[model samples]
Target: MRVRLDYGKVGLEVEFPDHNTKAVLGLKPTVPLENPTKAIAHALRQPIATPALADIARGRRDACIVLCDITRPVPNRLLLPPILETLHRSGIPKERVTLLIATGTHRPNWGDELEALVGGDIAGSYRVVNHDSKSLSAHRFMGTSPNGVPIWIDKVYTDADLRITVGLIEPHFMAGFSGGRKLIMPGVAAFYTIQRWHCPRFLEHPLATNGSVRGNPVHEEALAIAKCVRPDFIVDVILDEANRTTGVFAGDLEQAWLTGVEFAGKHVRAAITEPVDIVVTTCAGYPLDLTFYQTVKGMVGALPAVKQGGTIIIASECAEGVGSPDFAQALWETSDLEAFVRYISQPDVFVPEEWQVEELAKVVRHAEVICVAGGISAEKLTNCFVTPAESVEEGLRMALAKHGESASIYVIPRGPYVIPTLC
Candidate 1:
């Protein structure tokens, strides 16, 4: 059987032996909205829980809208126009509105990248700024969470009279689902705040995995931080495999996001009767697979579908290479996955971007991981403790030889976008 896995700009197609292939998992098909522009307008006018967006914007003088960074495939072009029009109609001028990119600890998007993020027309006309988590002065201390996480948010967002966030709702590896409160916490949060939130205390929690919210420490703390900011509204959307908006959720930050999560969960999740010996996956392609740091999600997402001693072959373009300087350094320094886990588990030791490595540790402990990332040299990937493969076919050949020709195999074309759970 030939399967086209999501990889880089164009997909990678590989042929697998029919006798060994168990199943090829993917998100259940959902129809895209025939008229997304009309849907966006309707969502703003008849929002969930809260009053219409126009009504909410009536008395507010200034508004700050938060957007996910380029890594996430949010439909900013479609979601922003109607929202800006409503805010303008309700008396707020273009000058008073700010579009803040919620970059978190990730680098800022600028120039042509920024234009592509929000569109040339809006980028030229509007006051768009990138969140600088590194600049402590840029953040205002919003007090601390019950769990003792410092709540420092970008003043650009908190200073505005009205706060709103626009995000894409998908199954997040740590926080149950993305969007809503997430656009505030790690989105615009300070580096220190993000460090604490991503520490093993929360990320190590059992409920912190994908498709869970209740009792998830990561989700709980993020919600607490967002509550301090008190965002007046939110616009979250659910997308199909093609990245087309399938559902538009706008209104009360929590309510609308929860509604979208419920709707998204049904489609993004797939169930398997048993675990497989060899699993092949990707980081969902393009912007998401640009760095190995982001590609960790694909590894962790495939964990549930593979046997404990099985092999996982992940294909990510890593077009920009491994990741941030800190992440790359950490990956290079780590000689032993067990030792790395032990060191990071200590309360006093917290390295920047180690959470991703820590998550990778979970996969390493369970199964052998072979990476098919062309951007990174074989030496670098080997130093990071992952077996590097020249191609997915080569990786599969090695795995099949180790597990025998009859090994059950599962392929996840969209990778982390589709959660495969055991029944």
Candidate 2:
């Protein structure tokens, strides 16, 4: 059987002998929006649990629109113009509106990428700024949540008379689901705030796993943090396997996003009756897999379907290399897997990107993980307690050799977007 996995800008295809392949997990059949621009406009006009955007922006002077940075597949080009028009129609001048990229701890998005993030026309016409979490001078402390997460957000986001955020709703490894409240917490929050929420304590919580929220502290905290800003509106989209917009949820951040989350659960959750001997997956595709730091999501997603002590082969096109120098340094700090866990388990350890190490540990504890990619060096992969393979085919061959010829294999082409549930 020929299995095609989503890779980089293009795609990767691998042929597996039909005998070993048990299943190919992917998104359930869902219709893509014929005209996403029209759908977005309609959602804005008839919003959930709030007034239409035009009515909300009627008398507001300054407005700040928050957008996810390079990592997300948010279709800003299709979503932004109609929003700008609504602001303009409500008498808010374009000059008073600022487009802020909620970069969190990631590097600033700029130049050509910035243009593509929010169309060239929008970039040229509007004032766009990148959030620098390290800029202590640019943030305002709004006290702390009941759960003790510090609430520090960018002044640009808080000072605006009207605040709007654009994001894509999907299954997130840590937060249960992405978009909505997430665009506020780790999106425009300070480095200190982000570190507090992502601490080892939250990482070890059972409710912190994917496809949940009611009792999940991570989701609850994110919602509380977003309330600090009291954003006026939100525009979150649901995309299919092909990255085409399939649904739009707009209006109140809470209600609209909850609606989207329900919609996402149906399409993303894949039920499996038994565990597989070998699980092969990808980190969605380009932009998502551009860096190894982001590739941890794929490993976590494959966990439910792979048996303990089984093998997991993840292929990513991490063209940007390991992506986080601090994460790489953290790997080098520990001599072995147990030591690495101890280093991250400390409550006071404030290493940047340390959360990645914590999440990677969860997967490593369950099964043997082999990373298949050329961008990350084998030496670096070894230090991180992951074996390295040059190709998915090679990784499969090695895993099958160890597990025997009858080893069952499951493939996840879209990675984190598809949640595997043991039936």
User: Over the stretch 1-423, how does candidate 2's per-residue lDDT look in tens digits?
Assistant: 998887788878998878888889988889999988889989999999999999999999889999999899899989999999999999999999999999988889999999879989999999999999988779999889988888999999999999999999999998999999999889999998998998777777887877888888888888998997778999999999878999999999899999999999999999899999999999988989988888888999999999999999999988887876887787678676556667767767777887888888889989999898768889877876789999898999899999999999999999888999887
In candidate 1, how many Å is residue 43 off?
0.9
Computed on alpha carbons, the lDDT of every model, listed in order, comes to 0.92, 0.89
Worst lDDT run of 10 residues, candidate 2, spans: 334-343
Tell me which residue pairs clash in candidate 2. Answer: none
- TM-score, model 1 to reference: 0.99
The numbered model that scores best in TM-score is 1
Looking at candidate 2, what is the lDDT of residue 213?
A: 81
Tell me the TM-score of each prediction against the true structure: 0.99, 0.98
RMSD per prediction, one decimal?
0.9, 1.1
Candidate that scores best on lDDT: 1
TM-score of 2: 0.98
What digit string (tens of lDDT, one per residue) describes model 1 on residues 329-422? 8888888877887888888788888888889888898999999998999998988778999999999999999999889999999999989977
